[model samples]
Target: MKLSLLLFFTCFLYLQILFSQDVKKQVEVGIIEHLDEFVPSDIQLMNEDGKMVNLKDQIDKPTALIFVYFRCPGICTPLMDGVADVIQKLDMKLAEDYQVITIGFDPREKIDLAIKKKKNYQSLITNQNTDDGWRFFTSDSANIARVTEALGFKYIKAGTDFTHAATVIVLSPNGKITRYLNGTYFLPFEFKLALIEASKGHSGPTMNKILQFCYSYDPVGKAYVLNVTRLSGTLILSLGLIVFLVLIIRKPRKRNYPKN
Candidate 1:
């Protein structure tokens, strides 16, 4: 009876190990294909000039994307304002290397409204020709849906409010998501760092990136962060070590038990 029980438990443990191995394999596969899966699609979006433009064709260089509704009274307005403040503080030469794209989530908004918003932001920038670097646009529902889907942006319209991730996504010149800044407001320093990292130090300030690397997330500060995948992996590894230690400590006791 004892041997039968042991065999049953052994088989259960073996199955558990196999299942875990399968899960780990799946996770590795996911990580391996993450970049390929996330490459932005060549969805057509309308330009400020009311021309139908393909997103991939519009990229003269790397770009940052902000998702918002033009009429958003709560988060979107201040979010854009805060981002504009950061852009204002950046040196013009460094800022010229990248473009800022504001995509309105509201389908009713026309290209004229988008052009107005672009002009508003342009007025805020201290440097001339910031318009060449910064841009804004609104697209029809279909194109907006396509671009947001590509970027993994989920939103629900709640009467007068938009319930969505208040985030900014940084994309490579080839339109791959490099880093995402969560929350409506972001620190200029962290934005600068992410830009530098993306540009490989040929664009944004290197010294600022180094100085700001060690700072952790502050919810009130609305700072950018490393993604949750890193945190979850650390947690899983810690739990694995604890389980291994517990098994090692229990093995000797089980071996020493009297044969009954």
Candidate 2:
């Protein structure tokens, strides 16, 4: 009787634990948002050529940062294809305004593999005018962590497989994340809107980047705005100029009285 009772209790505990897990999963699903605000400024990673690169450095121009493993036969290839298609459909003027940077998630993948994948993607996107916009890179674990951690992108390695999200981040010319495209079904309108938003309605970061030296792309406004520091300085300088002008204009005029 004692043995039978112990077995029954064990089964009951298992059921309770299962139910608790179900509840936790339900909560997680309910709480999931579009993205969890992952933006990294100082994060740096090594390129396939053994050169160091950072997101901040890319802020000089608008770059589409995509994360995927070169070996992914399922979602990654199609995801990349879809992005290529989206870029191809864009008008030439719009296409030239931005750049695409693809990073392989698997550090084990070598530069040759990355180069091959890049070549395949290039074949899919035939816009000769925008050829320069696309790039592929491989990096080590340290750089990957710096980037993934800052962007709130997470992944799990189970045996030989990886579980990760299908997402791409559009950063302003200044390297700040302006928008995130999630899932396989990416719409051209959304991508265009995000690109314009990132470009800040300037049509692209033609002039603002040099003067401001910051990563900021506002998709809605469609123009690059000054970074916080530059914006502040501009405001202060304007105020000072106004004060100086008032002093000059209001300076007491010398009395024009006849010589005594």
Candidate 3:
């Protein structure tokens, strides 16, 4: 029984590893988040009018910030659509209660593309001044780096495209990060609450990221791959636990004794 316990514990320790080598190989380039941290002051972007503007100067109300390129072949459009849908459904008035700012992370993109995208998404919502609230932009790579790094939005360029997480960053009126909404779709209730909290300068961590914990982002495939190592490790550990229990619970066999 002692030997069995020792073996089980050894297996448990081995199973817990789940192979760090896989994590080391996979680049962790998603939203790391800097809750309550103020966005850096100097990050500049070229607005739809082709004029340079400081990002900090634009935040008079709660803002939802997004990072994307105009030419993305995946995820970006759906994310923008989700934001537009939420905006259309929200009871709070747009441009008066809150605003959305989207930045094209690729420095090579120009403000003209941003303007076209603004119009494209603006068409999705009605009965509101979409032009004023849903703004798009482009910036040089340096400014892009500064803003993304400050907010913990990480991405990698891959053959003219990029690999990034789909998320919207909520910021307070004073430019402090208040929340992050992950994934392509936004719930109107949650979106409204995030904006409401931002208005009050409240910082909160939103973790609708169970899939991220269970999966690994595959840069080459541009999809989330299951972390088999973790699953396999857990399965092995479960088997070991069962074996340990059996060893502990089963009665020891008694040898027949001759009449003394």
The numbered model that scores best in lDDT is 3
Tens-digit per-residue lDDT, 165-207, candidate 3: 8899999999999999988888889999999999999989775
Which tens-of-lDDT digit does each residue in 88-122 have in candidate 1? 77653433677787888788888788788877877
1-260 per-residue lDDT for model 2 (tens digits):
46545755665576556544543433311112223243566666555566767756655565677888888745677778877888878663433677888887787887788878877877766654434567677778877866766654566564565556556677777666666676555677777777777776222222211332332333344233446864565466557656755665676867888898
The 10 consecutive residues of candidate 3 with the worst lDDT sum are 18-27
Clashing pairs in 1: none
| Model 3, runs deviating above 4 Å | 1-27, 208-210, 218-221, 238-260
Give the CA lDDT, 0 to 100, for residue 42 in model 2.
Answer: 62
Q: Stretches of candidate 2 above 4 Å error? A: 1-41, 48-50, 92-95, 129-131, 201-260
Please report the TM-score between candidate 2 and the true structure.
0.60
Report the Cα lDDT for residue 165, model 1: 45
